[model samples]
Target chain A: MKTLLMTISRDLKVAYRNPADVINPLVFFVIVISLFPLGISPSADVLVGIAPGVIWVAALLSCLLSFELMFRSDYEDGSLEQMTFGSGPFILVIMGKIVSHWIMTGLPLALLSPLLGMMLFVPPPGLTALMLSLLLATPTLSLLGSVGAGLTVGLRKGGVLVAILVLPLFVPVLILATAMVQTGIQGGDYTGHMLWLGALLAIATGISPLATSAAVRISLSH
Target chain B: MLNVRNLTCIRDERVLFENLSFSLGAGEALRVEGSNGTGKTTLLRILAGLYEDYEGEVDWALDEFPLYVGHKPGVKDLLTATENLTWLSALQEGQVAPDAVRAALAQVNLRGFEDVSCGSMSEGQRKRVNLARLYLTRASAWILDEPFSAIDVSGIAALEERMNDHVLAGGLLLLITHQQLQLDCAVRSLRLGV
Candidate 1:
């Protein structure tokens, strides 16, 4: 737990020191969210109806955009190698990275979802549900995205490849999160969708870190 | 103390080395001398427990892990020299005192550059930053792959002196270097011919 916290703190420090890293994803989220209103129907009702999916998709893409930067920089600089050979298990190191990634990218996206959703004309009640569902679901995104990030850490042009590899895995989260918001908007009980989101988060948290460590080991071997 | 017997390494369908055997007792130094492409780095990796494709038995009589420093200095370009050392110290399970880190950097003639981003430093300077890490960790064994590739003459002498001190303090050193290193110690040289 101490090593995990240290890794997370190191990552957070790195993230905070680099302004462009934080701003790029936030800008991407805003720009992607803004496009929906201009490209889709101008009717407020139609825009509000589609806001949940739009916000979720934007958040997913933003998270995916930041995932490549998670392990690649450390791997290239040899910190990843040090962690692998260090006292702690590599999976624990990976878990720390995932937690830091959530704190930096996922948590910020969750916090900003309401404003992004509002831009799409999402009503207040649905915006609340969207934020709640994203809060539960984005850590799962960070965890699963880390596996792809680890697998492609050493490859040239790994960023686009990571997006291609991880975005498909996010479909269930996207569907369930948006469904929860839509159900809330329709005055229906959203407990079932929230429950499914929680299950996905649980499963992802349980399995992805170990898989990511294996993938990182393989990548380093080559 | 460290022991390795029957170590083999294979890379890219080519056997780099096979049936390699060596051991180092406390306060002993082993220098791996080899031509280019002779698998010195790969052997170092195997010894450092980073590569497991080889068949070998390794035993150590120490509580600390062996420190491996590869050709790359492993310092992040964006981080200041101090931050780099701090993160490395944390990863290695050592408490890195700022004063100690600063002293190490000054010993390497990198004073006043601790707050500078490593990307701005010269190649020799970057190598110095990596050498400073040796002063920060208390690992019993050091596996250094090409530790003197781009360092200046003065830096090389300082590094040799540091290695000599480490050996004097009952530390084991496994170094892969192309250039000849002058040191006063019980040195064992292993040459790999391709």
Candidate 2:
């Protein structure tokens, strides 16, 4: 447990030292959402109708933008190799990394989402639903995205490959999240959508670390 | 003791080495010498369990994990020397105190640079920060891929003395290097790509 905490703290320090890494994704999220208002109609009806999908999609893309940072530096600097042989379990290391990545990208994105949703003229009732869905769903995003990050870590231009591999898997979460917000917009009960998102998060939390650890081994062999 | 039997590695449809065997024991230092692209790093990595695509039996008779210092050195540019070593030691489950890490950095001629970020340091300085692990590691075996590169003449001499001391103290050492080792201990030589 101490070792896992150390890994998490170490990763946090690394991420903190590079402020741009933490800020860029958030900026991308805001910019992408802002562009939707300008590119599409700025009126409340059109914006409210499309608000949930817009916020969710922007958040997803921004999260993807930061996945490259997950394991690339560690792999390049030989830290990942040492990690495999370290006394701590490899799964612990994977878990620590995923946790930190979510803290840096997913958590902040989820928090910033309501402001963006309001800017898009989403109904007041839907704003809470938007934040709640993102809170549950972005963790799943980080979890699933980590496997892709681990697999393509060795490639020179892995960002695109990560998107190609991970975006398809993101469909379920997207559908569930957007649905939750749409129900909230109509002042309908969103408990089912939240339950489904929570279930996906639980499933993703269970599986992603194992898959990522294996992916790291495979990437190291290359 | 470390034993290898019929260790063969093939990469990109080319056989780097086939049917090779060797054993290393306590109080031994083996220097792996080879030209570029001879799979010296590959063999070291295989023994370190970082690569497993090869066919071989690498039986490690010791209990502790080997301290592997690879070509990349594993030093992060954004972290201070102390932070890097603290994090690395924690990774290895050693958990050396901050003061001891500072002492190791001093031993590597990085006395006052412990708090300085590695990015601002020179290549040799960064390498010394990485080499500081040698002073703190308690592992029974050390697998180093070129521990002397980018080091000055005195640094190389100091490191050689330390390597000899480690071997003479009953620790095993396997290193890949092009420089002729000038140590007092018996240095075994393995010429790859013959």
DockQ of each: 0.57, 0.72
Please, what are the lDDT tens digits per residue for candidate 1 over residues B115-192?
999989998888888778888778878989888888888889989999999998999999988777898988999887
The model with the greatest TM-score is 2
Distance from true location, Cα of B114 in model 1, Å: 2.1
lDDT of 2 at A148: 100
**Candidate 2 segments whose C-alpha is farther than 4 A from its true place:** none
Q: Which residue pairs in candidate 1 collide?
A: none
User: Which CAPRI quality tier does the interface of model 1 achieve?
Assistant: medium
Candidate with the greatest DockQ versus the true structure: 2
Model 2: per-residue Cα lDDT over B1-194, one tens digit each: 99999999999998989988999999999998899999999999999888889997899997778999888868888899999888887688546788889898998999989899998999899888888888988888999999999999999999999998999999999999888789999989999998
Clashes of each: 0, 0
In model 1, how large is the Cα lDDT of residue B106?
Answer: 92
* Whole-model alpha-carbon lDDT for candidate 2: 0.91
Error of 1 at A6 (Å): 2.0
Tens-digit per-residue lDDT, A43-149, candidate 2: 99999999999999999999999999999999887778878867778899899999989999999988898899889988789999999998999999999999999
Consecutive 10-residue window with the lowest summed lDDT within model 2 chain B: B89-98
Alpha-carbon lDDT, every model: 0.85, 0.91
